[model samples]
Target: MYSWSCRFGLMMAAIFAVSSGQALAQTSAPPVKASLRLDWKGGGQHAPFYLARDRGYYKDEGIDLDIISGSGSSDVVKQVGSKAVEFGIADALVLVQAAEQRVPLTAIAAYYQRTPIVVLSPQSKPVTDPAQLTQGVKLGSKKGSATFQGLTALLAANDIPMQKVTLVDIGFGVQPLLVKQVDAMMGFSMNEPIEAESAGLPVTVMAIADHGVDAYGLMIVSNPDLIAKNPALVKGFLKATAHGLSDAAKDPAAAVAAVNNAVSESDPARETKVLDRTLPYFQSDDKEAHGAGWQSESRWEHTIAIAKKLGLVERDLSAHQVFSNDMLPH
Candidate 1:
């Protein structure tokens, strides 16, 4: 027992045992087969999604959510609608648009309580008023983005014709404003603006929530057949998503750190700013009263009202046909 050789061997074995135990703990969870496609790249709005993966939130709820990047919200919705994917983090407006076309997808639960749409530009050439932008101001937005749709609604509401101004399809991010390609750009505030500001560019954001377009944002979507066949799975997804949002709200810096682990650490400061603004959407007066998940009555009615007024919907549809509160955890 007192021999140096024996002592050295025991010490090495103990070290190996501890290392092996840690490795097993980190790698023991079985891979789940769930597939989720996101319309946007990683950001604060995506923190809950990243949290669901990193913190074992989805796995704890018995789902192996395999979230992936997607081309756009329309693509995400189309894939989920076609049963090619189990879940999609997509715009709430896309569901309304799909229902208008009689597509058979349903929103199980919502993520952002407020839409993430925004008009990003430099403070020098800002679209301070939605109407003012059409006064020969150049604009940029993704071709089919929710914000682009809202931009149309905003112009209609303000009596500004779109053709009078420029509407360039700048893909994503704030390339137009940062590079001075366009006077203003419309996209996700928590995503593009935050990204632009972090990249050392002076950026100003006009969130649609602040711009009089307070529509519901990202929601969890699934095929209606899946909802009828396995409602429990949908409920679990919502509960986990809601829980992840709540946790992120309580400790956003740590939440961003968790997200940063999945993404990049170069922009933690900017990511936290976006998270702070985005968290309030998760808890509205209705959500506080109705528990978690999308509020079917008030929120849906407002969205439909806006869609109808903006001519985005042919006729008003019942909220029940589009969204359901039954999947939410009571």
Candidate 2:
């Protein structure tokens, strides 16, 4: 896959240089091609990228995005690190952990401002406190998955030892929770919760955000090599993506329609339900009131602190070594 770009950087830089009374001789910039992989399965959650493609935002920027579904968070990190694709969406915790283990990856944009991880249980025996999740309870989720890693982080943060609870693997889908095979399952705030709701299963969504575990969710990541070699391509991808995501939030119905065109998993009724349910997770211009997609400096520091606490990052790791938003779209 090639790095995508619109060849706009040189022109913009030339304008700035000329304004300073500098004799800037400009050469024709070559077109650049870039490929992108997002962590999705053609569901309502991926409406933004779908809208962006249908609206030709990616094409305008010379990006040939090949959207792919990664089953787990680590997979996304691995794929991006190996330069398999230009960018992929993955959880922040997993990325942090992988980076600590020497995996090369960096987040470019934040999808959900809040962490979507949760300790789910029946509405009756809701696992509200960290103390209630004891050894007797059978928790169901997947290993190397965002939910499992997030649960691990949550437990560590709350001082709830993992040995106290019986962790069970439940694979990708939400079947284990729905069948009463497990007391509670760690699931997405928007996705699995909606799946449970659609099946008439009574469940309480205890958002990780509610439990003092705030982190960025669904970030765009790229290889360090690609980032260094072709920053303009990365910036173009982010700008087009921001445009697409912004459009998706304002008109979810239209977003779903575009998603339906590419994927059979997306339809009018089912997808509309998913869109409405997942809408709460999205933060937009209307919600943020001039908020941008970049990570706040203070928030980044807090995230680093969490990583250090969990030993997921080097205690001495400088923030400069971990990330570079110099290529991010403004």
Candidate 3:
């Protein structure tokens, strides 16, 4: 038999080997760093992303996401195309325009199923029909904005002459409407109507969709090169995002709270109300059938047709060239 000391020495060596192996197994790889560019300033519409970050959903997916604000949806497209950001949220119509310009961007997921563009007017003098907008009725809109393009498309598709209504360039904000600078304004269903109501100005909202303008709204976008080289990263980010959105849909209050906590400038009460109004746009018949962020081919065709009609795109780009469902989680 071996001496006791020799047996004890062997046992000690075994213990050390086991400890080292455990330590190696416990080591974790560093989280992948990625930046997400929002279409515009942070608001209730951005709650899902903030929810994901606040709840450590992104960390669970091995991604360290940096969510940044954007000047506009069109600018977000350019930012993603130039690789300034790995991903971006932008208007799907803008993506079509960008694709036509060969900007090298593709929409991976469509977040807003219904376009939020709307025509806001006082309840007292409600212009319910598109044709009701006539020569004397001044419509305020940011020149060259998606809302303006959407308004123009709605009028054109409905056989309403553009010259019948006057288009006034009113930068951002509802001051023009509140001050009666314009009889009506082109704004978002979730944005301006809420603000108007809060200010005790009852308004009638005419959704562009109700006027025959069928188009996709906000979409998750990325460059083709990113999808080609780091598909796993793209998949992980989308999976986490879908989970966050699912949870947000279940509890919008919690999602809004997450946004309020993450963003210093955010107003919790207002954002809570904003989120309530915004969530409906995130789901539709298509989303209910497939899942959230589902992009239907027919909808894309309609969007492309609208862009073409507006002369927003110079070349004809097929729906496939502008959007891809390949990156969405199964």
Candidate 4:
């Protein structure tokens, strides 16, 4: 056989070759950087994005996600359509409206299964039924807001004339309601009602969905160009989001903590409560079967019908124009 020195040299060379191969195998490509715009500022509703980022779900998907706060759902749609951002979360109806206007945005997933828009009034006034909102009742809402559009749809569905209720253009903040400036306010079920109750004002909440306005809530949207060009990126982002939402549903406390950690300005307890309230909106009998981020053609048709009723769209938009569930994680 071989001399001792030759044998040792051969063994050393084999060891070096294995070590180099291991190093090469351990090397990973840098993550792809991407941005995601939210419909509103950081809150409990945004826990999934934060949770995904904090838990390395995006990292696992090869995405370096930057979650950006947005002004409103409408604004988010505009941003995504303009390609100001690669992705966004917005109201489903807003996406319908945008698509009708040929905004070039496509919804990839439905994040909230049920609409969260509501009419908040003090218990003292107690406008429980949509029909109860009679003439001379002042309702506060921001002009050109998703809430206003939803309120309009609710009134129309209830056979109530828009002129019967006086519309007050109150920007943001519950001051208009707390100060009695407006008899009722248009708000989100998980937002303003909680604030009103905390401020020692017993509030009556009339969920728009309960009042005959059945529409999808928040949805994840992206530009058609992006979806067509970089489909892998879109699929990867959606996969990470699906994982994040699944984890959030399993442990809301962990999700809330992730939000609180990312947005220190938010009160952890309040965010926790918000996350708790938001979880149900993310699920439904249908979603339970198909999984989170699921979209239905029936829901899209309903939303389009409402948009047409509200005069938000001139022509009927097909479900294909508004949303595509193909990208959702299986």
- Which tens-of-lDDT digit does each residue in 1-330 have in candidate 4? 999999999999999999999887776668889999998898899999999999999989889999998988888988898899999999887887888789999889888888999999999888788876775678999988778988898988889888888889998778899999999999998898888887889999889998788899999999999999999899999999988888998989899999888875989888887888798898887778988788889888999999889887899779998988887778
Clashing pairs in 4: none
lDDT of 2 by residue, 1-330 (tens): 333444576677778878655433323233466656666676777788888989988877767776776676677887888887788877776677776677888776666666777777777667777667775778887986667767877887788888888888888667888787888899887677666777877788777766767666766788888888887788888888888878887998889998888786555777877777666666744236534456655555666677676666665555555555666565
lDDT of 3 by residue, 178-255 (tens): 889999999998888888888888999899988898899899999999999999888888888998898888988889
- Overlapping backbone residue pairs in candidate 1 total 0
Predicted candidate 1 versus true structure: per-residue lDDT over 220-247, tens digit per residue: 7888988898877777777887778777
TM-scores, each model vs. reference = 0.78, 0.78, 0.91, 0.89
Model 2 earns a TM-score of 0.78
- Residues forming the 10-long window of minimal summed lDDT in candidate 4: 128-137
Model 3: worst 10 consecutive residues (lDDT sum): 22-31
Q: Would you give me the overall lDDT of model 3? A: 0.88
Off by over 4 Å in 3: 1-27
Model 3 residue pairs with clashes? none
By descending lDDT, how would the candidates be arranged? 4, 3, 1, 2
Residue 257 CA displacement from its true place in model 4, Å: 2.0
Which ranges of candidate 4 are over 4 A from the true structure?
Answer: 1-27, 135-137
Candidate 1 ranges beyond 4 A from true positions: 1-33, 134-136, 142-144, 163-171, 263-274, 308-315
